[model samples]
Target: MIEDILSINQRPKMDEVEGVLFCLLNMLFYNDQKKTVETEQISIALGKDFVISFQEDAHRDVFDLLRSRLNMSNSKIRQRTADYLLYSMLDLIVDNYFIVMERLGEQIEMVEEEVIRRSNTKSLARINQLRKELIVLKRNLAPVRDLISGIIRSESDLLDDRTTKYFKDVYDHIMQAYDLGENYRDIVTGMQDLYINNVNLKLNEVMKVMAIVTCLLAPATVIGGIFGMNFEVIPYAHHKWGFYFAVGCMLIIPIWMLWVFRRRGWF
Candidate 1:
């Protein structure tokens, strides 16, 4: 049997298959920091008396339970056909979809909460990364789902009568995965909307502050302009206390504006 498969850095070519029944299951491999998902394919070929599986490497898998059962002398799998082993492997793969999606669901909840509370460039970046990863997952998973469905519908001796029920269970899991993808897509959309609304809300606050400050300074600018005029009969410009009066006017106007703003609850 093929064990855990290596990731894309430098993977060895898989051996050619020569068999009547072949199943290729590509799983999503996720990286936390990068929020990346890569496809890790597990190739399984079934024969009348033996099952051959190929993987990237030697990592442990969801098949540990089956392995333990195999260790037991009188386990049901030992009594069953090799096709039963194939079903067991496929069932494990489907069961794993639930595990991966559960982790993703937690991540979605965390991101959703953060988006609602406060958002930053980093948070948005994370959200975008998550969306892309989900897209990749969906793209890789659809073909596997179709392949399983086709197997269930096909009249093939490769799948025995006893394990047909198990394959159907795997089909249910694939359907659940589709539902999860749709739900997460909606959630990602909601996160994007929340992010935009928060940004616009911040901008509106900034504009409001600028508008209030501009209104406070408008009178001072007008007074200063009038006093600095080149005309000969300027009243305040000629007065001994002209400078003091102009300064006083500038200060008082803004103070009054502040009071008005405070009373009107504009600030």
Candidate 2:
């Protein structure tokens, strides 16, 4: 079990040996400096008289509140058995899940607004990144849900009957986190589809503009072709105003088409 804690990419789980209860969980915390979520392996052992916890990082922890409660003489944690201490620690870890989720939720909301306002390549990239982060969160959370369930059903004598209620509360929290992760996954997927539709809409607008320009130029092309024909005799070919007449038609036709289009609100 110690070696499991030292290993990379350890999945969250629980085990019992003799009378001791062991729990391995992947803890997530937001790194404010790096603007990303970081995972840490946490191993907890609950024995008859004491509870031991092992953390990968010595500098960071979510256990300050637990320590403070332990120091209080009138605290329920100080009055309870080691099983309650174990529950307290697990509760702290699960509570931090809410905090991390809140941070990611804000990011998800921002990316969602970007997608709806005017999606660009940058918005698509942000959506992809958010998807990956949510996947990481789901990856860590799903197993922890199972691990908590296992603990609730275990027959370990180290766990007190009274403390089981506290663990059940923790179980509820883990289940809530799992559901939130699933909802975020669905939202990200919808955002991805919306982004694609927005891109297609933009492309269709460009095509529409190109088609209108081609139509407006069609009359000029037809008149020029007719006037440029190689013929010994042609109507208005020798007229003094022939050049001005052709130029005026070219200008007038496009302007007239523009006015018609504007009246009909086509562009």
Candidate 3:
């Protein structure tokens, strides 16, 4: 039914009139031949009796509500000019921007929970993935906001004064979405910093404990080295209990060092 209304090939062109032409449909909705919709280079022209709209595709028509309004027997869209239809379509696209932001917010919250509960390497990888996704979204969405802004401020007669007002509403929604994307990006950055700091603190604690253990054993190692030497005149070498005496010294020296450290609050 929509194709029938937009079938320029089948319809006869009336005498050239001067009105704004609005081809406000998704390029992706069309056949596979030209799937990418270049919103920046959207085609618009002035025609004879009515403004002609050449929607490139049929799949992602953001103007469903406008279609429904037009289908109604008593709809203002049917009575109004083509410019009004264009306004309605643009408004729907702007509304969809809010929907996308809502989904993004939920995703960010999930990432926040994961970051807080786990400070592993896997968490850092996940944060990177999220950052990339947000970057792509920001890139795609920024252009859309600019395009809608152009439509609102454009002086083309195709856009009636009242229709431009509707476009302004769409422009505001785009701005809000842009702001949200930026905020999410900042949050991801902060999370990355926090994860790095947490990992570093844990490593420092481990190194400190290792250093203290090595310090506590230094005296025992030195005593063992002295007894292990092959010299024959060592003081405790020839007694019947020489081995026991050496073992006693090794044990006593380490215990005294540990006690001194504890008294000084090193432990």
Instruction: Please tell me which predicted candidate would have the highest TM-score against the true structure.
Output: 2
The window of 10 residues in a row where model 3 has the poorest summed lDDT is 28-37
Report the lDDT tens digits of candidate 2 across residue range 1-267: 778767767888899877778899877898766557888889998888998888888888899998898789999998989998888998999999999999888888998999899999999988888888888898889998998899899878888888889889999999999999899889999999999999999999999899889989999999899999999897777899998999899989999999999899988
lDDT of 2: 0.89
What is candidate 3's lDDT per residue for 1-267, written digit by digit as tens? 344344532221111124434332222111223211122212334333354454445454455776788789899878777766656655666576555556656666876788788788888887787787676556656766766766666677666787677777777877887888899899989989988887887898889788777876776688778877899888777888987987887778778877888899875
Runs off by more than 4 Å, candidate 3: 1-66, 235-267
Q: Ranking under lDDT, best-scoring first?
A: 2, 1, 3
TM-score of each: 0.83, 0.93, 0.69
What's the C-alpha lDDT at position 107 in model 1? 82
Better of 1 and 3 by TM-score: 1
lDDT of each: 0.76, 0.89, 0.63
Ranked by TM-score from best down, the candidates are 2, 1, 3
**Where does model 1 exceed 4 Å of error?**
1-19, 32-35, 240-245, 255-267
- On lDDT, the candidate that comes out on top is 2
What is the lDDT for 233 in model 2?
A: 94
- For model 2, the superposed segments whose C-alpha errors exceed 4 Å read 259-265
